[model samples]
Target: MNQLNVCLSPALIPLYNVEDHIVVIIDIFRATSSICYGIENGAEAIIPVSLVEECAAYREKGLDYLLAAERDGKVVEGFDFGNSPFSYTKEKVAGKTVVLTTTNGTHALHLSRAAKKIVIGSFLNLTSMCDWLKLQNDNILLVCAGWKNNFNLEDTLFAGAVVEQLKTGDFKPDDAAIAANDLYQLGKHDLNEYLKKTSHSERLKKLGIEKDIEFCLQVDLITAIPVLDGEMLVKLQ
Candidate 1:
């Protein structure tokens, strides 16, 4: 049986042997959820860059990349859009390559480069993500992109949701995975209400982007699974 572990924050990734595991990068407040929705809506690919400058550099590559940059819960100045899933409509992203950098999600992707395989995870594609994961032979590592390297609730709750799904399979859960599953069970009934007091939720509320929170919490709206292929995320074929 493959073992399943959850790393609650990107800062703790170094403690895990990622090279031998399939890493699921979770940033449910926005990034991964947006990736899933964009790909499902016909995005050609998404290029996750660690820095805003790196995302900008893709513009000069002549690929007509759509640049999406986010910082501190808002769209960066001079970018096409931020990390909101609503911004990734079919009319906008269809057959286009998006170069994206977010405050936490892209940073977590960079930190997880050594993993055997890296896939984006979010509530948007929860069932499909777990279905694909169960078919893989590699051990699984759920890496949460917490708020600025500090643990956050939304990502951890999503990780816990994944753990709940995978635990019924031929996978053994680590302590973190166990904790996440428990947390998910506690919050699954009413996610929006359950997260009302979380720091990230409060932060987004103050930014007046509460709708993004409601959207990200929707389960299995997308069937696409975005997997990292070299430097880009493409829908799993």
Candidate 2:
């Protein structure tokens, strides 16, 4: 059986053999969720950059790229928007390209670039992502984009959810994956209530973006899985 491993935080990524595994980057609070929404809404592609400046450079190239940057849970000034799924409506993003940088999510994507293949994951695309993952031949690494290299509850919970689904497939869960699956079993009944006190949730609550939280927690709302192609995340076709 292919082994399924969960790296609880990006800081733990160096310990994993990413190049031999298919990496699913999870940032359920916003980034990966937003990616799923944008791609489903028909955004041509989303480029994930680690630095805000790198996202900005795309603007100078004179392409009509929509730039998005977020830091500490708030949209950075001078960008079109941050990592909010609602901002990626079909009316807005259809046929456009988005250049994005976020405090946690994009950074995790950068760290996992050496993976055999990289895909974005969120509760929004949970079922679709797992269904596709079950058909893959490589070992799987679910890399959570925890808050600033430190473990956080929401991301871990999402990793656990994936573990719960994939456990019945051709995958064998490692210790971390087992722990995550257990966590998911405990919290799957009411995700919003389960995450009420999480650090990232509190941070976003303070910013008054509770809608983003509610939307991100919804299961399988989006069927598109955003897979990395070169530096861009496009809907798996």
Candidate 3:
């Protein structure tokens, strides 16, 4: 049986890869969700960076692109946008590059680079994400985009949702999965109930994008799996 481990928060993420495993990245607080939405709506590509400077370097290239990032739940200085999926429209993202960074999710993406395959996960594409991950031949790791190295409810809930789907697929889970699976089961049918109390939700409310919170919490609304293809993430079109 292949081992399945869940990293409870992005803060715990650094570099831990199984010999040949798949990585499922969850960042429901909008970065990963926006990428999934962009790809589903016909985005060309998304490049996630770990640092503001690295994201800035891509911006300097002057590609037909949208500059997006956030710090402390607010748009960074001079950035065209913050990390909200609502800003990624077909008119804005179509045939254009998106260089993205966030307080948590983008860093988690880089931290999970060692895996043989890195797949983005969010409520927007949960079923397809699990289906794609099930096809991988090795172990699986679910990396949660927690709140700045701190534990957050929404990410772990999403991770649990994945574990619940993959629990019987020759994937022997670790202790973290135990908690994640339990948490997921408790909140699957009422995710919004659980998410409302999360730090991400409060931050979103503070930013005045309450609708996006509603958008992100609706499970299985999308099934387009967004996978990392080299430096840029795109749909397997």
For model 3, how does the per-residue alpha-carbon lDDT over 47-75 read when each residue is reduced to its tens digit? 88777778778766877777887776678
The whole-model C-alpha lDDT of candidate 3 against the native structure comes to: 0.80
lDDT of each: 0.90, 0.89, 0.80
Best-to-worst TM-score order: 1, 2, 3
Give per-residue CA lDDT, model 1, range 97-167, as digits (tens): 99878768878888899999999998999999999998996699999999889998888899999988888
lDDT score, residue 166, model 3?
90
Q: Can you give the lDDT of residue 114 in candidate 3?
A: 75
RMSD (CA, Å), each prediction: 1.3, 1.4, 2.1
Model 3 earns a TM-score of 0.90
Number of residue pairs clashing in candidate 3, backbone atoms closer than 3 angstroms, sequence gap of 3 or more or interchain:
1
Candidate 1 pairs with clashing backbones: none
Q: How many residue pairs clash in each candidate at the backbone level?
A: 0, 0, 1
lDDT of 2: 0.89
The local lDDT score (0 to 100) that residue 142 gets in candidate 3 is 88
Q: Estimate each model's TM-score.
A: 0.96, 0.95, 0.90
Task: Compute the lDDT of residue 202 as modeled in candidate 2.
Answer: 59
Query: What is the TM-score (0 to 1) of candidate 2?
Result: 0.95
Best by lDDT: 1
